[model samples]
Target: MTAASRPKSVYPLGAKAVRILVADDHLVYRIGIRNLLGSEPGFDVVGEAADGLQAVELYRKLRPDVLLLDLRMPHKNGVEVVRAIRQEHQTARILVVTSYQTEEEVFQVLQAGAQGYVVKDVGRETLIEAIRAVNAGTRWVPPAIQKQFSDRVLRQELTAREIEVLRLLTRGLTNREIANVYGISANTVKNHLNNLMAKLDVADRTEAVSFCLARGIVKPEEI
Candidate 1:
C-alpha cells in the first residue's frame, strides 16, 4: 500500500474528545498550549494550573483524559503531582511536559508512573501526536531525546561518580586537583575521566568537557 493509504493510529474523528489539563508555571506557556490545542478538532482544554498543588486539585476535580505537566513548579513539582494522582487513579494518563531532559529528571518522573514523557522544545505536530498517543494508552518520547537516553543505556559509560568527575572536569580541573578536592586517589580520578570520555564519545579530557558542556551536562558558570 502507498504511504497515503497507511492507517492512522490516533482516534477517529468525532470520537470522544480528549479532555486535557494543562499545568505550567508560566502563564504564557499555558495560554499558548491552550490556544494550540483548543483549535484542534478532538482536543478539549478542560482545566489549567499554575503549580503542582493546583494541578493535583484540578486533576481531582476535572479528572481530565490527559495531564500535561511541568517538572519544576512552586508548591509542588510535577513528579510529586504525578505520584499523588497515580495513588488514587492508577489509570491516570500523565504526559510529563517539561524543559528538563536530564537522565535523573526523566527517571524520577518515569518512576513516579508517568505514561508519556516529552520535552517542551518538541515541534507542534509531535506535541499533538504525543497527547493523542498518551491518551490512546501508548507512550511518547521525542525521537532526539529517545536517542540520547538509548545511547546512554547502551554505553553504560558514566556512573554517577563519573558524571561528577566530568562536571568537575568541565570546570577545568586537573585529575590531581580533582583527586585532592574529592579526597580520592589520582588514579581514581583518571579512571573516572576515561569512563566519561567513553560515555561522551570523546577522545580526550578537553573533548569530553566540551561534549558535556554542549549537551547541558555542565552549567556555563561551572566552566
Candidate 2:
C-alpha cells in the first residue's frame, strides 16, 4: 500500500531454464531477487524493471515464463500491472512478491490473475516453491494469506495503529511522513496501511479513507 517488497519452473524437473522477469522499484531489492533466482539451477532471470510502468513494458517485450511483481511500485502498482499484463496476455504467470500480507492485497492480485502471493520475508524454500507451484499451474496462496481468506478475516477489525495510518494517508501524508509520525520505517508504515486496507476491504489508501469516512471510522473534521 505504501512501499515494499520470483521465478519459474521446469528444468526444475529437468526441462529448460524457466525464464523470469523481476520487477520492483528498489534497485537493491531487485538485485537481491536477481541474485537469488540466478543462483537457482533452472531459474533464469531475463529482465527487470524499477517501476510498474517499466515492468509492463519489459513484460511485453520479453514475455517471460514468470513475472515476479512487487505490490507497491511507483508508476502502476502491482495490482494495476497485473491487470494490464493480463489484459494483454491472459496466461501470464505472475508471482506477486510484497511485504503486505493483507487479504485484500493478496486477493486483489490473485483475482486479477496473479499465480501466487508471497511475503517478502519468506525463506528460500518457500519462495522457490511458490515460484515453482505457480509456474506449474497452481494458484499458490500460502498459509499466511490462506488463513486470512477465512470468515474470521472478514470479521476482523482494524487496529489503532492501522487507523492512524489510514487517517494520515487520507490527509496526504506520504509513507515517509507517516513513518516519521510513528517513529518507524517507511516500510512499516506501508505494512500498517496494507493491514488497514485488508481490514477495511479496500484496494488503496483513497478507497480505505473513503470507506472509513462513509462508515464513520473517522470524523469529517479529522480529514
| Model 2: pairs clashing at backbone N, Cα or C within 3 Å | 11-15
Native-to-model Cα distance after best TM-score fit, residue 14 in candidate 1, in Å: 3.0
Assess each prediction's global lDDT (C-alpha) against the native. Answer: 0.83, 0.82
How far does residue 123 in candidate 1 sit from its true spot (Å)?
A: 1.1
Error of 2 at 141 (Å): 0.8
Candidate 1 local Cα displacement, residue 171, angstroms: 24
> CA RMSD for every model?
7.2, 14.5
Best candidate per lDDT, number?
1
Candidate 2, residues 32-74: lDDT per residue as tens digits?
A: 8888877677888999999999999999999999999999999
The clash numbers for all candidates, in the given order, read: 0, 1
Please identify model 2 stretches exceeding 4 Å from their true place.
Answer: 1-14, 150-223
Can you write out model 1's per-residue Cα lDDT over 144-186, one digit (the tens) per residue? Answer: 6665656545345457788778778777788899999899999
Q: What is the lDDT of residue 57 in candidate 2?
A: 98
TM-score of each: 0.63, 0.62
